[model samples]
Target: MKSTLYLLLQIFVLVIFRSDVFCQEAHKWGGQKDGTFSNPVLPADYSDLDAIRVGDDFYAISSTMQFSPGMVILHSKDLVNWEIAGHVVNDLTKVSPNLDWSSMNSYGRGIWAGSIRYYKNKFWVYFASPDDGFFMSSATDPKGPWEPLHKVWDVSGWDDCCSFCDDDGQLYFIATNFKLDPNNNKKYNIHLFKMSQDGKTLLPNTDSIIHQSPGSEANKLYKINGLYYHFFSEVKAEGRVMMMERSQNIHGPWEIRQLNHVNKTVDREPNQGGLIQLKDGKWWFFTHHGSGDWEGRAASLLPVTWIDGWPMIGEVGKDGIGNMVWSAKAPIAVNKALKIQTDDDFSAVTLRPQWEWNYQPRSDKWSLSARKGFLRLMAFRPLKPDDTVRILLRAGNTITQRSMRTKFNIATVKIDISGMYNGQFAGLTHFSTKSYCMIGIKQDGEDRKLVYSSDSQNLIGVTITGSNVWLRSSWDYQGLNRYFYSLNGKDFLPFGNSTQLTWGSYRGDRVGIFNFNRFATKGYIDLDYFDYQYSKQ
Candidate 1:
């Protein structure tokens, strides 16, 4: 009987260990046994991403236009499944916060098209905020409290900076010149500069021209098997990806590669890409696809080959195929299958990394954790006369037409409107830059009503004059419109014409609870629960 008990104990221990391992593997965004893939691996407005592999670890950084915490760093063992490792700057003032929006700029003025490289036991990043200048920073670890900005070459209209340290430890900077012609002041060119021994500054005397495409951007340099290659985007009225190669030196008598991957056919425009070699000795290229106006861009990868010492990208026989494949298999380790959280429990110290503001965020705008399991937001004054400061929250990735059936109850939200603007309101909103729809509670005399409004100039199409109310909003892709608040959280009323507004800069619409108290005085709102149910349509 004692022998039997010992065998049973061994089985119990094995079962417990297997359960813990399963729980840990479920937190990651993807890694299913099926061959299906996630649409955007790095979701939530991340665009123009550049990634590199150092030994077994992978690191990536992308464009953060006008956002304060700029230059985000990501880590992954496999090319897929990335997480926010750290940030270069926590505050905007560190790298020029004040921006001029009237020039069609400021909103997207922070770092654009950053490149990450691991050199000589240190990780380095080269990024450009064209409005300011190009800058570089380095850290001992990929996840870092990185060193401050080391200004390299300061020139306006210079963006998408990339760097390479050659086999002999000589550093080179490859970037596009946005300056108009110094001669007739006509167009732009691709320029190269050699760096000093320390890699902190550029060598003053070593400036040369590698190639000049009138409207080209995102220039990158690579050397393989003693051959030097230059890759750039050749922007015509129609955008195209063009390549040129040289044999002798880094500064080259370069020759243009005949085949173009993006020539007004399968793809509308292909932008920046990082060329990397897999562990199995095969080459792969990662590039992005443009989404017109709604969604800024989506990333794609394609296989590349070296034929007679020249790189041939995409596949020749596949006929303009852009998705690349690397020989390295996905990492054996699994990611924790945690669902991307959108519903706020207000138990954490700060907002989730998924949230963003329309403009530069003020530190005092919102507060959390003081009230257990509740988020408190102080209303801000509006910039325009007709509008209130719409503190828009991000709608998560799971809000598809098919994913709306999952029932969520939020009837416990308690909001105090005694200190709001003369016409200020507080409720839930689904906002886009061009269009928006909201179901809110506004003061009517001395009472509150659940009123609905869309961009079509309809005010209070439906109303419920009550203090305790429940609101929900949903998108119908087939009809290309939105359905507004339901009193019981089951029935939804269509508010206006089809919302027609698609995703831009990133995917999905911005949907969250908000308060607009046009007056500058601080007023607070209490939310008990802001829950969303993810279901199959």
Candidate 2:
């Protein structure tokens, strides 16, 4: 009897321990860990994210660079577990048919500082492309047919414009004008104007220079308890968030808050973000951190509290160390975790929502069918390998690691090079100036060859007419420096080491597949499938 009782106790203990482990893993993807905070909670490259709180719901939008589906819209309840609600821009061909990330025209250009607000039972989003101009779109529902883009103003170098609707129903637009005054040598200045009653255009004669801070960008205005607060970024060699308030009328005598300062991460220069008060009366600040390169800029969130009627962000205790809060539960839990499906079966007529084409994507460039479960990419004449116009996919999240696995042999993956205008081929690549790698098939007369190369600038390696090949690519935290190819999909062979490439004023690298067929022909390449997995590393 004693032996049986001891055995029963052991079984009970094991059952309890197993249940505990299961619960922990289920909560792993949701809640905050004990005493630990998740920095860059969003691992993907979500730069210049502006978050807005409406009731208990939180919505955010970020810069999409030249990607086809620009202006990604995200929703969160607890400020974690974000889901791609939808896209602001449906197609890029309507905007720019060709995108050049290397050219000065495309560098640091695209959607920036999107402002989301609820006004009179409608959702309004103000998005700006400094290279182009400012645009506004609205929808009654969060997910829907967002109204067509309405050009508000065509001022030169205008970026990061935000809108505020007063309690009296008067709408105002706040923004920074980059028109340089040759005499003063200053580039960016803040401006404000009241919108027409119809909301279709700006009200004339209401345009006025509200405030001008030298080198300041992304100016936003808010009203709280009869006080008008203006928030903006001071972009010196280093960047910092600056805030000022006024109790007087909208015209003048604004008092700059003495304690208004937010710390910038070593990577980012305090580019842009948003401030909101939670339903519980707690204040929170959301902003982006520059990753040294333009590509590395990712979004981060911190807590804020008002002390003596002024905002105190990232406050430090007596030890002079700032504490970032960690919450296991989201501010507002939804029906499901906010997520985007990354797994691809290559069996659909259209590309997955998680996939984005660099710059602009041709509508008929690629396709999928339910019968074959394979992705058929049409091949055409190749453009410059480094050009952003070539078909390229986007890499999201910085801290989350993604791995792609495929089993198809290289010989079976054939490319039809019949209609050649210039030169064209299909391959997998790490698309970034800082670093890149490609394993592709090149055409030689009627036969095809396999070529592997890296942009590290150290060495280039290619294997002509290689057979039975499986390729794998990855980008490490230090920058994309690792490359390994396989034949059986079990063991990988290290290729040539190379030097890193750098673009002007940008950081981070993107990994994806590319086909350099710019001639617009109908040739095609067969890909079995691509499996992408992400994990916190």
Scored by TM-score, the top model is 2
Q: Each model's RMSD to truth, in Å?
A: 12.5, 10.1
lDDT of 1 by residue, 302-328 (tens): 556666566666555454333222222
lDDT of 1 at 64: 63
Task: Give candidate 2 regions above 4 Å deviation.
Answer: 1-31, 96-105, 236-238, 258-267, 316-336, 339-341, 369-372, 382-423, 433-435, 456-469, 487-491, 498-507, 518-522
TM-score of each: 0.74, 0.78
Candidate 2 per-residue lDDT over residues 173-256, each given as its tens digit: 888887768786767767788997656578888877767766667567788878888777664443454445565566556776
Tell me the whole-model lDDT of each prediction, alpha carbons only.
0.56, 0.57
The candidate that wins on lDDT is 2
lDDT of 1 at 96: 60
